[model samples]
Target: MHNATVIALRTVATILILATFVPLLPFEAWYIRIFDFPRSQIFVLAAFTLLIFLVLRWWRYGIDKILIPGLVASLVFEAVNIYPYTFLSPVQVQQAPADAPADGQLSILVSNVYQHNVEHQLLIDLIQEHSPDILLTLETDSIWQKGLRPATDSFPERVAIPLSNTYGMHLYSKLPLRQTRTRYLLEEEVPSIKTYVQLRNGVWVELHAVHPKPPVPTEDDDSKTRDAEIVLVGKEVKGSDYPVIVAGDFNDVAWSHTTTLFQKVSGLLDPRIGRGFYNTFNAKYKLLRWPLDHVFHSDHFKLVKMERLPHINSDHFPILAILSFAPENKYEQEEPQPDEDTAEEAAETIEEGKEEAQEEDD
Candidate 1:
């Protein structure tokens, strides 16, 4: 190969490899954390770069020292980070018990209906069509709440906290709700809903719906608040004796460090473990999508069904999941357990969030 061509290839490969290191830094800035959303894309790019380097390289110079090792490391890191979300990985949550009666099943639909989105009827129609037992909507405001009221009238039990700041939440359930409250976990402007709902079989299940602010230049400068809110929920649900379900657009990917910590701390299992990345955000861009919407459950519930619904004029695609409460299947699934380091990190993150909130209050 020509000397100029060799130099160009080495430079390109080096740049790609270096880009993968952004997520490894122990920083939560939006510029760095955004790298965590595209591990799959990064893996594809790194693998392609490695293949090109292998086929076009010569042993003429010491280029091998810099380019080859870097490319290899990048490929390995990306693959390891994204491997769990692939089909080759083992399922984290087991299927619902085959013999469990239909009465034990709970169907839920969660959507982050972008506030400025004008197509309110699309969401209303979807709700009527799916008729899920519980409907949780985020990014809702007064206009959205009023528009959806008629369609959701059948959902007699409701909790609505409408705001125009794009942090609104509304939860409607057909089942009877016991002790439902809208709490501001970290930021008072951001609301989270917690309630105990009765299933058809007269069994009670605790449910939490949350939409933490995304770590972006426009939304939040860092991920501390988002991480803290998620960690707090995880810690709260960890010791719960009742079956628990936490669902919504978390504004973070399933494989992120904070999310993994959340699962381990809460003893919750993501239904997308062995399943494909049901990429729900950035509905307009196919390649830029990730699984921002999630449905996690405790061991007492098994997955009856899970799916990513079609896009509704919003930037996010809705998610629907049906879970069955069968104690027998609890042993079939494995729950995540955080090691000493992760536990300590979570506690520190929560404390940091508390201090920041206090400063803002003062």
Candidate 2:
């Protein structure tokens, strides 16, 4: 009985340690990249294992000395990735002052209404209640488009792409949207919206609404296409003359390597930094959730208010962000800039995505 217990503890410790380092591999395979989602869960399990080890006084077993170090290292790695999202870290995007001008403010709501969940009235009611200046919805089909008409009617300007493929997106804005274009950046079926939104203050801000494909067995074999699309958008936003805001269900975690790289490449700031995770996905499963939906903006904007909204009969919850466009104070917030190596890596990833996409099409 004693021998069996020791072996069980050793096996569990080994699995946890390996899981922590699996994502470090330079691979895009779904099996490996999927490990990127549950860093917090892994941390908890590692901590629990370490406690059990100490409680059992397993150090007397000698082998535990080796396993203990591995567990500690895993905990440290996960902590480093999760720390920036906690309040203990410095905020990457500054908050707007209490006296921030109302005219310079813009509120956005982003939701991925699971396509088959037809409780449209719940979302409609939520929309009517919040009344954001801009609304972006993913997984909208023809039925969803019609179902959301009551709420969307209030938004005078819009871009609607209704498809059954679950990648359909719709962007409705109370503020005027100019030069709106629906782009199939990498995959033909997947669409992204790019446009300039004229804020109430008459300042033009570039907005990109995207719902990139996820790395899952049912979706794609790997994350190359998704990473490429994000990087492509990042590269484009890097040179934008106007202040930029990119928001949607990223299908990637806020703390993942791809997201970090995107920030560096685009010079965008995430308001969640030093705030909270604001986990939006897996609304159905509290224990298994992460911040897959994101809203990233240029330093020109300061966060006024950001919150995760109530679930509206979907697998994912909505996120609302009220930001004040304060370009004058942009210099106060440090922007993430990509070094030469990062730029080269981003370029290579984009090229690879394009090649893979072309090959798939062929």
Candidate 3:
């Protein structure tokens, strides 16, 4: 019985250590990339395992001496990945002053309404209560389109692309939207909305609403398309003359390598940094959740308020953020820039994604 208990702990420790290093590999395979989503969970588990070792005085054994060090190293690695999202780190996006001008403010609400869920009224009520200047909904099919019409009718300017493929997207804006274009960045069936939104102050802010195909067995089988799409958009937004805001269900966690690269390549600020994780996905399960839905913006804006809203019977809870446009204060915040190596890596990822996409077509 004593040997069996020792063996069980050893086996669990080995699995945790391997899981920690697998995501560090430069592979785009779904199995490998999926490991990037649960750093927080891994950190908790590693800490718990370490506690067990300490309580049992396992370090007295030779085998445990090796396992304990590996567990400690894993904790350090996971902490580095998730540290920026905690309040202990400085905020990437500064907060707006209490006297921030109303006209210069833009409040956006983003929701990934699971296509099959028909609790349309609950979503509508939430939208009405929040009254964001912009509302972006993902997984909107024909049924969702019609169902959301009552709430959307108030927004004079809109873009609706309803499809049954679960990649459908809709953008409703109370403010005027100019140069609105529905683009297929990487995958033909997947659509992303791009437009210039004229704020009440007459400032035109470029907005990109994207819902990239995730890397799952039922989906593309890898994250190449998703990573490529993200990198391509990051590069595009990098040189924009106007302030930029990119929001949607990225299907990627905030702390993942690809998301960090996206921020560096685009020079955008993540408001969640130094605030909290603000996990938005897996709304039904508290134990398994990550910040899959995100809103990234240029340093021209400062966060006023950001929160995860109540669930609307969907797999993802809606996220609402109000940002004050204060470009003059942009110098106060530091924007992340891609170095030579990061630039080269992003370019290669984009090319690989295009090649893989072509092969699929053929």
List runs of model 2 lying over 4 Å from the truth.
Answer: none
Q: Candidates ranked by lDDT, best first?
A: 2, 3, 1
Candidate 2, residues 217-302, lDDT tens digits: the string is 99989999999999999999999999999999889999898999999999999999999999998999999999999999999999
Q: In model 1, which range of ten residues has the least summed lDDT?
A: 56-65
In model 1, what lDDT does residue 119 have? 93
User: Per-prediction RMSD in angstroms?
Assistant: 1.9, 1.1, 1.0
Candidate with the larger lDDT of 1 and 3: 3
Question: Candidate 3: where is the Cα deviation over 4 Å?
Answer: none
lDDT of 3 by residue, 1-362 (tens): 39998898889888888889998898999999998998898899999999999999888888899999999999999999999989999999999999999999999999999999999999999999999999999999989989998899999998999989999999999999889999998778999999999988999999999999998999988999999999899999999999999999999999988998999999999999999999998999988899999999999999999999998999999999999999899999999877879989999989999988888888
Shift of residue 43 alpha carbon in model 2, Å: 0.9
Lowest summed lDDT window (length 10), candidate 3: 1-10
Cα lDDT computed for each candidate against the true fold: 0.88, 0.94, 0.94
Clash tally for model 3? 0
TM-score of 3: 0.98
Residue 115, candidate 3: alpha-carbon lDDT: 96
